[model samples]
Target: MAKKQDNTITWDTFSEGLWRENPVFVMLLGMCPVLAVTNSAINALAMGIATLFVLLASGTLISLLRNSIPKQVRIATYIVIIATFVTIVDYTIQAISLDLYNALGAFIQLIVANCMILGRAEAYSSRNPPLKSIVNATGMGLGFTLALLCLGVVREILGAGSLFGIDLFGPRFEPWVVMVLPAGGFLVLGAWLLLFEWLKQRKSETELNPASES
Candidate 1:
């Protein structure tokens, strides 16, 4: 028999999805787009929002249909749900702003292939209650947004001398052209990952050695 889960545990599960087990920074599930579209702050923000929308929508639908879906075909069903939302977001962006839409291009449609969405559906949404599943999905989406925003800020400031379309360092500071290139994306992401890993390791060591008397 399965042990009854406490409400507090559910909250922990949800929170962990956001930070501790983030799909991008921690699990590193979806990196192709994260590195490709993050060349500019605007592009990064747009991709993050689009991903969040798809994750939430797909998670909710999957949770709702968990009981009805057969174990064998669940993966296929979840993929279809995800693909539908990706198409909706893609067309919506095209209709709203052709420039932004063109900037995103095939990357927007590629959200269908993002492992985070399907991973959440198969791992959490399929087994958890609807409310809990939504919370988990939201947390994971927010974590992804946070990571993207960090990358965007770094790239934009160095590459364009501006952030979100506003110049921050003024005219005297020449933009580093490399920051706007693909190589810069890889460099920035690699450095950030290294920093995160170092911090996490230090935290773990500190926690383990908290009591000097031992």
Candidate 2:
């Protein structure tokens, strides 16, 4: 369906990734970092931004070179391109803040293997112009980042009584403890998935019977 388009930039192309086709929430791609590194809002935000950068950079480059590349070697080329950007992010993070760098750990390097960026390269960028690809990548990256924040913010607030390390409640507030654990990632992600699913279903019903919403 995407290939059928004339590669024009439209709001749908950008907004689809933010909601309708969100990489994390809707498509469930790149769950590794989504669940592993999102225990805190800061970590989630940092990871989201990093992924967004890689996506935008790699997508733009891939779109420019798409026509010249052999179809058989495209995937390898995509990975190399993605890895170059990931390396830049990984080192930049390390130089900026060792704490954040350690917090994210190997997951930063793993962005190379993230299916979300590669999928965009193969599916959207390769078939579209650079401008359209940039718009699409921006939306998709934000969507993925938003999904991470959804899980991270809730988990951090409940688990640590904080948001981005700021104490929200007080010393009197007892943290959930579990919210910061590996298990917390699963619980939060599950709850979010259910909520999004319900919302989607409700939207479908409303669209099918417009009067019902009124």
Candidate 3:
């Protein structure tokens, strides 16, 4: 079991989500949307923002009502709260851009099932005050967004020879069709995971080797 945090709020409470506990790279939560809708940069951004809003809004509401929620039905209650925000996101996206809505498909609605948001609610938000929960959720949301963009931008550029639908390479350049495919998501995600792991390993080695410091 994880240690429970105190009421005190610190920078680490928020910043941990950005890198140390990134939902995608570090913690590996919510990979469904991460891989499914990240073929294009625009799609990835939209999904990330939607999930962020849900995380923040739900975290706030859950923190405020944490005491009242019965322990027996807490999980069910959390889902209800999460689903409400997801519904709002669903309708808003439909009104904003039909093309984007189609591109994202059912993944947007599936945000309700994202363990990252639920985990925050059950583990963090339910224990902390609203203010602290908001800060933590913001950091986590941004981290998830950053991870999605990393994959999306790379996939889009290599797959379509463009970013956010804007052409970068001319007609002469051939796009790597695999980058935009489902296999592309797996390939890119594996590559990113390897890179982060390598960096972490190198950092650990540096810390252990006192001689290298000299």
Give stretches of model 2 more than 4 Å off. Answer: 1-3, 210-214
Query: How are the candidates ranked when ordered by TM-score, highest leading?
Result: 3, 2, 1
lDDT, candidates in the order shown: 0.86, 0.92, 0.93
Ranked by TM-score, the better of candidates 1 and 3 is 3
The true-versus-predicted C-alpha distance at residue 76 of model 2, in Å, is: 0.6
lDDT of 1 by residue, 51-138 (tens): 9999999999999999999999999999999999999999999999999998888999999999888888888888877887788788
Best by lDDT: 3
Query: Could you arrange the candidates by lDDT from highest to lowest?
Result: 3, 2, 1
Which residue pairs of candidate 2 clash?
none
Error of 3 at 129 (Å): 0.5
lDDT score of residue 81 within candidate 3: 100
lDDT, candidate 2, equals: 0.92
Q: Name model 3 segments beyond 4 Å from true.
A: 1-4, 209-214
Model 2 superposed RMSD (Cα):
2.4
